[model samples]
Target chain A: MSHRDPLTPFLSVDAARVRRNVERVQAAADARGVALRPHVKTHKVPQLARLQVEAGEVGITVATLGEAETFVAAGLDDVLVAYPVLLDEAGLRRAAALAERARLVVGVDAVEGVRRAAPLAGRVAISIEVDSGHHRTGVAPGEAGAVAAAAADAGIEVAGVFTFPGHSYAPGAGPDAAAAELAALDAAADAARARGVEVPVRSGGSTPSLAASLAAPRVPDELRPGVYLFGDAQQWELGRTGPDDVALTCVASVVSTVGGRVVLDAGSKALGADRAAYATGFGRLLDHPDARIVQLSEHHAVVELGDAPLPRVGERLRVVPNHVCAAVNLADELWIDGEPVPVAARGRNA
Target chain B: MSHRDPLTPFLSVDAARVRRNVERVQAAADARGVALRPHVKTHKVPQLARLQVEAGEVGITVATLGEAETFVAAGLDDVLVAYPVLLDEAGLRRAAALAERARLVVGVDAVEGVRRAAPLAGRVAISIEVDSGHHRTGVAPGEAGAVAAAAADAGIEVAGVFTFPGHSYAPGAGPDAAAAELAALDAAADAARARGVEVPVRSGGSTPSLAASLAAPRVPDELRPGVYLFGDAQQWELGRTGPDDVALTCVASVVSTVGGRVVLDAGSKALGADRAAYATGFGRLLDHPDARIVQLSEHHAVVELGDAPLPRVGERLRVVPNHVCAAVNLADELWIDGEPVPVAARGRNA
Candidate 1:
């Protein structure tokens, strides 16, 4: 029933918790003797990516050319874009620009994608995407060697193979999906080795599959997990992390009470409309455990309470959004432990 | 299929179309002798609000204290917050400051809300909200008189009654819903008049209901319509508008082609994630009518095109987002007739 400040509905990141999670993930990779290339798609914060690098991460992963440019401008080298990029003329020019400053690695899963990225083939390294089980965008695992061979034929250096284990985020499917991802990567690596090409790195790991995938015998040389740095409702539900591990939270205020529903200042704009398939509500109210975000709009979230009284107007509370990645992408800056911290790469979504 | 601009994901609004829509609505209101208090919530731009005023609007309607403050700072003289506002200390102080320069009207739907506004009553005019079947906010029609009487007792002048026929947005529902809204407002106005309170203005109407409601029997003194200025997918689906009337559109480039799915550079951040229950897809592509936005992320919208074949990676397309209000809220500047116009009141989401 109290607000420390009136400016509610903003992004707040617990710096201590973020630092701890970053270090813990690095330690996990250290134990496995696999290099950690934490994905910047989660926080999109150059400061956090730098912390990971300082904590012994070998490199950082990005999803877009804009994101890679942002991190490279911030003086971070060794950036890999995990997404299967389809570069236009502008995108090709951007990739070459990034290659001038950092060790840029671009992902390609198709023959046409390689042709599109031909302009930067000599300048940047290319990685083949192996469709493990997600069936989203990557080429089949058996096709990886062919894709890699094609890229090599196009004058692009095929550095390694990578798969997303996107099914790992599915409910009760993390471990099995991680196992499948490792198996696919192993098959692709074997195929590449048979073709007299060295698959220097085989990367595959999501936050939910990080622990189990890293423990697998064939986890390759590097692991890429994004959301482990900022635990979300899905992470908590999947048992991949605990409440204390969550780094970012939406600081919102109770705005109005019409009938039984109490509306909050934060809505899809601040918290994001990313309700996990298995999540219970739109978000979790840390201040009121019994409160559930029933509905959300661009600027309003209606919270419903069960056997608990609603918070008064002007009362600020912390909300753990369903998906941390999307929520962080919407904000321009974040409060690091109640202290405003600039998110330098917030708007570089594309 | 060509975007000469470097920015891939952007929204463009035709200034001439906006002017036409503004003038059309103003003329419609003038013919009915109803004051046009256009809602600025849909497009939080002071310049656009000024356009409404210049087109002979009686005032401007807002949705939050932050918006009121923003418009007031930009020299808008009359503003009405259509939502039932909770006047907390900070909100009251802001309202007091805004009242110093502009005519401020705050909505109240409950006795408690009126009591909360008592401190700021001296500086604001209160309008009691009646539930006109929107069921989102406001009290029932029978309960409006008591709330209006309470506001009078608290020294807050009951300017009149207002309601939103939100149900009017549904197919085949606009006329009846608008009629119901007028009936509710009529009953509430009569009740307030019986209580010896001067009910000078009775307001109700959304975009779908505006045209019919203006012609309805016992039309209110003022009309507040937000989305008419920027026709979106919702308007098109409801048969209230045509594609040519869509002034705002998000321009994005085709980023990738995987099997039948084509990924675009724009996503929730640019097009917004607002979808109505009856909406077919996230948005409609202006050039590629066969493509549909199947899935959306923070930075990418997965568009699927069937047999028509997707556009090339470098090709650009314009997308009419499902909801224009939320999409407008996400941008800092809007492209008006292909020119980037600064949105003076953008990001005042509170």
Candidate 2:
């Protein structure tokens, strides 16, 4: 690949590093006898999805119908929208169209969600989302059976049970969050089976819980980890991945330096303003590990160089953002190696 | 405009309220005899820029060259990029091209920026950005004269002096920040005059300090307020504007309800993850004032309804985000009244 410096405040991905990450995760999942269905929400690039599929991913997972449509349009047939989608008329139409093109599996946490998705009964499979300590979007473990039954009664095919161990993102919370995810998925699956419904696919796993998933008493049949491919500062801080494992970074130029403080052109708009409670700073400068992003405006990241030399004007620095998914969503394209790849689902927030 | 409900998690603007906000701010600026140059970073729509110009704004202020280019291409001239630009090769080329289309004014905070931008000698005018306690980007008030002199020595025209009272975003800091902005601009202007340089324009003001600007000892010649046109939750919490004054809101659907907690389709990807330290919550539900967003994921905003009726599935709720500029950047289009208008400069963060 060419070594030309990319435009400042642009996203760049090391293709070799991404391939290695993909193979590493796939091998881990394979060793555990669990199918790896990488979440495309992290990169939102069809080419990366294709790479995952070629690397032995069973299918792909998405968070929005817009993302599912984008993946389906790119010829990725099997897709799961792991979100409790609000079935408005417009949403139903979009989901129905997507179901026509792929083996679309949608998540439902409430009976109303099932009733709303009844129109696409034959076309779409419904997966009951169980709360696994995240408490963001999902039903209680005991309520999953009723939701699954409701979907089945409405003539929809039951996909199975799924939960996101999102709490695993917190520092020192991965193992417990993974254990909770296993219990929740097992309880939901048992509840569905007791109601005479078949639980075909059980899915659970986040970047932080990927390894924890393998050690759980009841391992999930499939894992859907997104951010593991492009490690972030949060992942680095959590010890889930080392600095060398980070594949994607925002290449930014030092725009201004005054009062011993350096400012990069990358800001919330480039690195995203997602600061986990455990995150040390907004982002970490790859070249200068000692530097910390003290402040972020819409277009500037103020860096406090503790002991590292201050970056000169126009000098580019790679920054590993606090959250990779949010960072990727903000980018229009990814500079893979030296080639520009469109972030097809960049703003696909439906 | 049609009366159909838009897709969930989409940005919607009230045309009437935007017009009212424009007139309100315009009247305020006119009363103080200060030219209003609305910062387009808030809305990023050319149509809104035209509305501001039609409402008596002398010109428009932008935060990036991409934004300046967007406005200039839309036929609106006299653009001021209120940023201490790095002036890298690509940046200089872009600035030169924008200067050909409009009266381009760029900000410089150091001699390096002035030297890098000297290539645009006759085409671009440079404004020395003075630090008014923000400490984000800008030279000290006393140092602005040297930067202005350096720019003049390089054959670039000196436009004037400007500072952003960004510290005013905090609660109870408006009056003090406004006074500081005025003092900084005044000091910079005096320094420039003493250096035998003409300071033609003196610009300062943010949304929080718009009202305080009028009462400052030395009122600025121009006011550049961005978020005033679309009030947010931070503005509401800071008592700058009431809930009724908010012109923009994200229309989201109640996707799930479990364990007395309701979840909306709007998440960080929709509402933007910009919770100011002094802000109340991620966002405020306009229809249900008692409802507060407790947590946000990539695709779900968990709301804790306090004594308010829980919304059912498929119900749409308007959310006033904590920061309007960050929220607008995440959206691809704005549903104005009932029609969709593309956020022309949505990801123009070059």
Candidate 3:
């Protein structure tokens, strides 16, 4: 904490810890001969993306075109939107304009998505999304051929295939989810190649699946893990990262202590109300590990102090949020050991 | 819904519905002889606050000094920060500066809060918060006298007492919470009056407890309800508001329909991830009333269409979030009938 008022909730990132985490993931990917394209959606800051790139990341992955524009404006040229984009006419124009400044790659899961993206064929590259086991966004492995063929037929370059092993976020589901991810990527690549389209890039991996991704027999060409740089309580609960690995923490003050419960100034507005199924509480108090955020309002996090000594009003505490990506998105700036760094891509949801 | 890209998730507010809701609440408060002080934390826009004030609201309630500064700068004079403020030297200086421009009122639950606020005694008015079964922030009703005496002893004017019946958010808890709130406020006022302090402002109420508050025998002198302006999924589930009463919705387009699941571009980043314990889902799709958001990622909302036709890729839909306050806070601007209104106090979570 700096000399600033501790009563206000602010996000603090340990730059050294983030650098170490970046280097650790990069080293693991390097040993596997895979490109580590860290997702900037977690931090959403150009400086952190530059650090990851400097530490040996091939490129950066983003969730929205606005993020791509933000990073591109920050001078990071190579960017991949790892989301299936269904752009309107205006969006197509924006995407085309963004492509002029950077090597933009967009993801497609359906043929309609590819057809809608046809206007940016020569300017933008397309990656076919294959659903491994998350059952969220990607198409089936067998359907990847059709989507890639459609993109290729529309003069769009079929760059590669990508899948998110999001199910690995659950406790004890990492290995199976990673195996499924690798199998799906391989199947999609094989299908695309069978259709006479080259599948150069194979991207898959999340924070929990990083080790499994590195240990897989069929390794991906690149990994897209977002939350590794700033581990959250969800990752910690999933046994992917230890408490020390968490880089970002919300610094909040105990605003009220009534009925043996502590109310923190940081609520959903600061920590983000993201609770994974496997996560126990809204967030964990770093100083008092026994404290659990039992309830969250817009401006108050009601914490059950349990057997821990009651935190006095105005005492500052650090909280590890359940989801760092959501929490980081809520913050306007990140404090790096007292230095405030603006979250350049904070509200770039579009 | 405008010429802009439909695929980008954006918040849309129904101006007509907002106006109706404001008038409705104002009428109810007016009939009950209580001043309506709508919490600006819900819709942190100066324009909306102006509408609220124009609709018979006595003043506006904010959660932070930053928000007070924002509203004051916008020329809305009467502002009350409803949270227990613990200010440092810089914070005190900021408070004094803000008090110069507006009739600022700060809440205090502990003696330390009052003591810290004593430096700005003449400039800022202090309110003692009372715990009315929602053990989130306030001191006990019996202890209100000591807190008021301390604030008065420190040369701070004891304005009134306030309590947030936040527990009323749950189903079937509204009446009991409202009764507790009225009883606590009455007890606190009596205690303060016995301490020779005038407790004129008796502020309390949440969206769920609106009816209960109006029906209570010992009604509060003022009401401060935030979420009634924009009903959410949680409110609907709690039977507090009907679907038509919801004024705000997240307009998102279906980007992927894989494995029979519809994935919208709006995820936790747009609709917010605040899920109450009794809530059914992350959010409910307005078009498909039965559809529930099964999972949420940074930019993907996986919706499970239960017996409803699966939303096609590129199809636009409106989603009612589980918590509107959290959702609105995530957005940079709110689209009011195709007009973009900047959320002036979006991240003023100081």
Candidate 4:
């Protein structure tokens, strides 16, 4: 351990924890006869995505064309860029090139996207993104018909109707958000069907709402939960996953013990600056769950010793980030069993 | 311009703005007869650091030893690692190697760090970190003497003392935070002097508090302000800088227009998720400051059109992140005059 104690403030993936999480999600998806297309945005490592696929996922879901390109280059053919990608000439060109070697399905919420993607209409496909109460992106459930019609009008393949239950991220909103996704997917499918689109694919799921949504009599044909691969503090606090399910942890060394404040080297840069309103702290101490990361600076995470023993300076601690997706995006690579694996799609915001 | 329209969600630094910012901070530091040791963590671009050095910064400040190594390897001779690095064997080894290459000064706030760096007792020097009002890292102003004495006890070089007025990053707290920094630095210097430490370097300054702290009769011997190079929304809102002073912007494409919500590809991943209590939104649109970034997901930033005209899908907008330091840490590179400059020490959170 001394020889391999990586320079403090690094991300490490527990392979066992990862396998447990993958199995848990895959088991749920398999039982319900739903196709699993786990979002790769949570753990951007190609190896992790491949693990999920081997564990029974149909394909993989990504957030951007750059991410899709990464996965495709890594040899994953089927990808759903599940964001309303506003395809400009560059985007269209990139999509066209990607389509040459893989099965790609972009996402669209407005007619403008369909128009912009007209150049690659036949080669590439698009899924209608429904709002489903997240209100962050995607059109409302009823508005899905117009977007689907525009895709058909543009001669683009309407792959399906998909929505992200992002509202599930809120405190105690899992069941409600799941209900929203269920209703939204159902309405969107019917609306697209009414528009004479086959509506062959209906996809919806976010880690927080996936479990609750699965309890419904009929779930979406496809699921795209991202963070189930590495449970985050938000998911753990929201009752979506337990502590044992968290696969990733930021290994941080205690750098300061000023006035009893146990400060860790893993600050915002390492754990990410995501303190959702409901999040107990900036992040959670994996070993000492009682401790709270009260503040995060550029390179210091100040903790409050809440029944947890104050960590001595130079002692290492494992931290669980609030939003694993955002946190993982900050790292260049992640350590798995003492070996490093590049975050293949990290910094793919473009 | 057409050829240079980068893919959505990337960081870009304007050369002119950067020059103006450097000149602005440098001019003030010169007037006060203080040294400029600009923190490079905000930009993390080697070229920009060189630009600042050419403009007359005495040295560069980094958050980690790895960052110091980057700048040192890039030909920087002087560096001050501004974080209280809790050095283990690996950390000590890295510090010793860096000290041999550059005039490096690591920060220390606790006796434990002094003990850990005992092996590098003669090769490296350390500055006592003083807690002004931020109370993040560092010892309280009065404890500086005890910590400095420990370094002396360990037969290590005690350079001086420094503090970050992080509390200045708040609504209408700039002046008070600066005042607190001034008093803290003064007390720390006196404390160190009492402990028979020379305290030649009395460093204290954050971007928000730099100007106000300069108003004191006598400023510290050195100023270490990072964000002044790239004005963020937080600084602009605090009246520390104007819009023109902002050198960095996240170039993001409007990807969705669901109902009235204008969603950009610059979500938490691109623009960063640091919305301080005082910040108006997740981030500010550089061109359309009237628009509010109401919400941020992993890959989507939802904006409310507040007097600002709605951006069309596929149209790109420049956004000023609320915290430039956190935002820059997420990007792999930054565009400078249509050329990509790698974030030299990005992800060097250690």
Two-chain DockQ for model 3: 0.64
Which residue pairs show backbone clashes in model 3?
Answer: none
Model 4 misplacement above 4 A: A1-3, B1-3
Give model 3's TM-score for chain A to 2 decimal places: 0.96
Candidate 1 segments exceeding 4 Å error: A1-6, A190-196, A215-217, A237-239, B1-4
- Order the candidate numbers by TM-score, best to worst: 2, 4, 3, 1
DockQ scores of all models, one per candidate: 0.38, 0.62, 0.64, 0.73
lDDT of each residue in B1-350, candidate 3, tens digit only:
35443336899989999999989989888898989888989989999999999998999999998899999999999988999877777678878988889898999998778888988988899888898987788989988988888888988988789999888988899889999899999999888888878788999988899988898776889989989988889988998888888999999888888777888889889988888889888899876778889788778888887898776787788999898988889988888877888899998888
The TM-score, computed over Cα atoms with residue i paired to residue i, of candidate 2 is 0.97
DockQ of 4: 0.73
lDDT for A23 (candidate 1): 88
Tens-digit lDDT string for candidate 4 (A1-84): 353557878898899989988898788788989888999988888898889889989899998888998999999999999988
TM-score of each: 0.91, 0.97, 0.96, 0.97
Cα lDDT listed for each candidate: 0.80, 0.88, 0.87, 0.85
Question: What is the Cα-based TM-score of model 1?
Answer: 0.91
Top lDDT hit: 2
Question: In model 2, what lDDT does residue B269 have?
Answer: 87
lDDT for each residue of candidate 4 in B217-336, tens digit (9 for 90 to 100): 768889889999889998888888888778899988888777888888888888788878867788888777687788887788888878876668877788889999888888878888
Q: What shift in Å separates residue A24 of candidate 2 from its native position after superposition?
A: 0.4
Please give the lDDT score for candidate 3: 0.87
TM accuracy, model 3: 0.96
lDDT, residue B154, model 3 = 88
Instruction: Show what share of the native A-B interface contacts model 2 retains.
Output: 0.70
User: For model 1 chain A, where is the 10-residue window of minimal lDDT?
Assistant: A1-10
Candidate numbers sorted by lDDT from highest down: 2, 3, 4, 1
